[model samples]
Target: MSLVEINFDGIVGPSHNYAGLSLGNIASASHKGDTSYPRAAALQGVAKMRGNLARLGVQGFLLPLPRPNHALAEALAYDGTEDRALRAAPWSASSMWTANAATVSPAPDTRDGKCHLTPANLVTMLHRAQEWPDTKRMLEVAFGNGDHFAVHDIAPVTFGDEGAANHMRFCEGHGTAGVEVFVFGRPGGKFPARQHEQSFRLIARRHGLDPARCVFIEQNPAAIEAGAFHNDVVSVANERVLFTHAEAFADQQGAYDAIRAAFPALEVVEVPSDAVSLEEAIRTYLFNAQLLTLPDGSMALIVPEECRESAAVWKYCEAMMASNGPIREVIPVDVRQSMANGGGPACLRLRVVCDPATVDPRFLLDEAKADLLDQVISEHWPEQIDPADLWSEALTTQVVAARTALLAALAITELD
Candidate 1:
């Protein structure tokens, strides 16, 4: 069976704002209460997707989750008035970073020979905790092929599952069985570890992956303290290549040894501590880049523009590109809006390996669909949204109308 990895990116929502909601996310906190350009943010995300599809020739897209999250306010026993609910509800546009969408086990690894996805419970942060139910609903609609796809519920709340943000898979090819790496964070430092060890184990067991092909590793507390909120902030893997910082994990050597023992051909690319400090890595979001296999059988690093601007990161990337390394080139994408919110190129997407035919047609993207989305974003999305405007009836109407237009264009009736 032929298989390929599709990148499904979440469109930025109309209510995208800087509420400084996430505790561990430095950018979110730093930019709290600042004015946000929701229309520009959505268009920037679309442009990135368009470029990826044009360059890589394969990509997919997911619609933004409904914003203002009035349901959450209602659940909290807030009055049903729109103004009251909007005022009380937390504005969460974090769903644009789809890496936290789910933990996907490809058909080759699962016992049932069907791809499985379990949405992250995301119980650590209140704003994020409200995403799972809507996320699960969207996932079910997008991956509706019952014979080939299995959409599972969110992990138990106590487990604190953060989904693909703390997961990586390595294989010879997308069609083959791969080694799944689950990186959990332990709480003992200044910054709280968002992922729980039990959560990692639970996901592995739930996926039914072979014991020999699964490895669990702990994240380095030092990295977390340096503002690496998610494993993706300091490490990312693609195929057989694992790109990471020197202090990314608690047992760096042990983790490497285990991975090598499982997949002998694995290539471990470690950026030495002296060359790039954890502070620089987090600032440039170097590890948050998308390591992709291009159509020419060579790999490319799709990084945020911030990496190119950082002298240290740019120097390292130039050296890497010059060498005969697995990464043949570096492609910089402008996602400044998302970056300010603590997400980068990799965070914006969820990677799923499958036969394209098995996915729901509405989730897949083409040039025509991209054009339509561009039109929707340009014509209907809000130009700017201040924190104080979150409760405005006019803004709510615009957001709802924009989403309705997008759903219609995508032929996604379930969301409508």
Candidate 2:
């Protein structure tokens, strides 16, 4: 059986705004209160999806979670009357970064012969914490094929589950059994490690992964202090290739050795510290680039346009491509709207490896459907959104109407 890894990217929402809600994200904090172009952001995301479908031939899409999170405000007893509550609600369009959506264990690795997914609690950050409920509903509706998929609620909030951003898998192919690596951060640093060790262990156990095939590693404190808020900031993996920076983990050699022990065929590509400093990696979001295995069995790096803009990063990418490495091509995508808010190409997607036939058709995308979605975004999405505009009753109504129209167009009434 041939299995493919499908990238389910989140459609950027009309509520996309730069409220600077992500505390440790340097870009988010630096660009606080800046005006955001929601229409452009959504279109950019759609365009990126189109590029993937056209170039890689394997692309899936997920709708944005309902935003301005009114339920959270009501839970906090703010009643939406005061501007303080409205603003404090975070109105987070952060759901566009679906890497934090869930941790998925494909059928090949699970004991039950069914794909398993656990929605992330995202409890460490206030804005992200509200995502689980809606995220759970979305997953349930999209992956409702009970014979092939199992969706579970997030682990306890105390466990601090940040989802796939802290998880990665490696194997010979998408259909083969793979080793699941869960990277967790300890709480002794200047910046909080959003993923907890307990949470990682709980997820591995819940997924019923074989003990020998599961590995747990710690993220480097220095990296966290230097603004590597999540493991993806420093490392990323696809199939048997692990693309990472030199200072990404606490015990880099040990982590690699452990992975090698489990999967001896693993290929480790470490970009040396001297070539690209951790600061440059974070600034350019080099590790956040999607390392994809193309239809012809070659690999390509789908990176944010910011990578090309950075002199050192772009030079490194060019060298990597020229060196005849595993990555055959470097495709630059324009997601500057998401980049400013601290997300890039990899951040905008969730990877699920399975037979396409097993997933709901509504969740998949093709060139024609992508074109229709792009048209919907262009016609209905708001042009600009300011942090202060989130409280207006008119804006709330507009957001609702836009999402309702999109759901109707997609024939997905469950979310509506």
Candidate 3:
């Protein structure tokens, strides 16, 4: 089975300035504390996609960690290294879980917002759990299938003290046998905004992932402007897939161009863009793996009411759809806010695994299946990611299973 493990956020920090304030333990760019509604909605969007994948017989699901800062803090405090080296780890450990509320972090104020430790913990549990039949086996399978590396909007780790330790625990938990970290180190101990393209190639080789199948594509944290990593960059498709986006309507032509050049051999289909803006339409284009043209002529796109007449979107969609075979179905989704924060439906979902075996037979055939599964995936993105063909087959599967058992036990005890 072919799977794509996606990490949200090409760089750390929420991109949308308008996204409600965060209300977790750590403070953020926004005046509002951690656990903001917008952030929750973003996570919800990704979660929704996982549920959709389950229905599609696609075993993959998004493996999401805590917020960027939250995760960064975790790693900083516990990567079994010094503070400087830990901080240099490729990604940050941000999260919406308020450390203050859970007594996880000694924030200046804990009562200011609602907080929960479960989301981040669950993320860790989901990613690291092992074996099938484990309580959260579904979560592990959906998120654990990754060898070759790729990421979406993932932020770099940046924090001190307990915050750092929590993030490290999460990363370490996922750093089991098959999982490979695709992040990179920054100079002077700061996470750079530029795309860490080198990390993609490096991790692919380090983990023994197939370069012919692995891929990492994402928006560079360095520039929310147009032309970040899009214009001219390419990498070998080492046994994995990584794709990221930052509002298409913005200056991201370069980023698009890079992807086009990267996956020269994959089948790409263009569809229609009926969304309100060009960015949303284009983002749909990327996830559908239709950014570039397939051997056929049609293009695949997300059909939204607003983009019915978008010439570029329509033309590409029509071309991809019209290619050798008809274009795949047009998926409708609501991702208006994601664009503001450098994300579209694809960015929000974070695909960790794809169950090729369970996927609809139609996906394997030349024809498209008119079903909600495709729609759900196009909409939520992460709900369908699976970590492996079967959780039992993975090396870390046992660990995850153990963790799941512990969690179930703890839950039962709490209930009593």
Candidate 4:
């Protein structure tokens, strides 16, 4: 199978904003500042998501963490057995990442060097994932045993950190089928900030990459605060295009047109606001970039509620037709709980592996449907009907219920 690498977003324990307020044993809330829902909900969400993926037959992957912080440690530690087949991508996690070169700054004198903390953790995760037979066997074949690490050895200061650089390295290793990174710049995780264009260009050059393939997306209104347009023509020269969608840009189509004109070869797609509400635009954009289908016929979809709304669920279904364009599929997820800090679906979910060929689909069955009828018969009609007969009827009812709920969720959740 062509290597499938997806970033595992919701894989970690439920991630809650703990800017303030606390819920019993769970840490205090940040960013969004809500402390009502227990962290258990997020944890359950992760488990549910994993089961969904596992059932889908997904295995062998890479996880590029937003930040390899203590929170990640806690999340992973919660689920012991640190399997090593999966590699933890360090590009976005390591603090030493600078846009100009791969090397760490501040003269690199201290042990706790800003970049050290996350890289160490990332490497640990990578090692753990690699230890597993599936991930180990596959990765060794792809990058050549340990040869992948050498790509990261180059001290390019351009990409911000080892995590992000490693991500770039993996992309580069893929040759024609390499990765195309779309860095979502906005208010919440505004690492590159307004200089997204400059940052991406510099990072691209440092990595011996063509800027044309890199995409820079500005998704936050606050990042564009003061109404300053950060779109630059120079950056567009490098294929580092900007993204402006109704759900993300306050000026939606205007931003889209601007980006479109800037990079003629770069195709700019319209994002439905209802597909990704203003509050969840950042995550929505990430979902589009990371999980959505690539031009090649494979899906990297991140299906949030927004996709169903503006684009229409049927349209999304149509879009996923696996034609000459890209393989597409809706990622069934809910982000209503995570929208407090201006993030929607993407913010809450992370993509660990993206190669579509690796998806395994065994978990999409309707277990809930089985439970409902069983409950009714056991409670009232226990001796009246044979168990097998009841099961037959229940299975039929369950299928209908599952399909209806899925369609309903898609219809109700959208970018608006």
Q: Between the candidate structures 2 and 4, which one is better when assessed by TM-score?
A: 2
Better of 1 and 3 by lDDT: 1
CA error at residue 4 for candidate 1, angstroms = 0.3
Off by over 4 Å in 2: 79-90
Per-residue lDDT of candidate 3, residues 1-416 (tens digit): 33322222111122112222211111122222122223333444434344334323332222222222234446335443433223222122122111100111111111221111111121211111111112122232322233321112112222111111111111111112122222222222222222233433432343234343333334333322311222111111112222222342122454334444544332222222342232443332233221111224332333332233456555554554455543444444444333322233333322222334433232221112213323322333222212121112342243233323332422322211
Q: Over the stretch 1-416, how does candidate 4's per-residue lDDT look in tens digits?
A: 23333333322111122232211111112332233232332333343345444444442212112222334445445343323211121111111111111211110211221111112111222322211222222222322323122112322233222223212211212212222343334433322232333444444444444444444444444423312112210011112222234444434555445444434444433335464343343323233232333335344444445445544443544654544433334454554333332333333332232234323211121344223322332332212111122123463344234323432432422211
Instruction: Report the alpha-carbon TM-score of model 1 versus the true structure.
Output: 0.96
Best prediction by lDDT: 2
lDDT of each: 0.87, 0.88, 0.27, 0.30
> What order do candidates take by TM-score, descending?
2, 1, 4, 3
> Which candidate model has the greater TM-score, 1 or 2?
2
Q: How many collisions between residues are there in candidate 2? A: 0
lDDT of 1 by residue, 97-207 (tens): 999999999989988888989999998877788888889999999898898889998777888888999999999877789999899998878877889889778777887
Model 4 TM-score, all chains together: 0.41
Give RMSD to native, each candidate: 2.1, 1.4, 16.4, 16.0
What C-alpha lDDT, on a 0 to 100 scale, does residue 282 get in candidate 3? 37
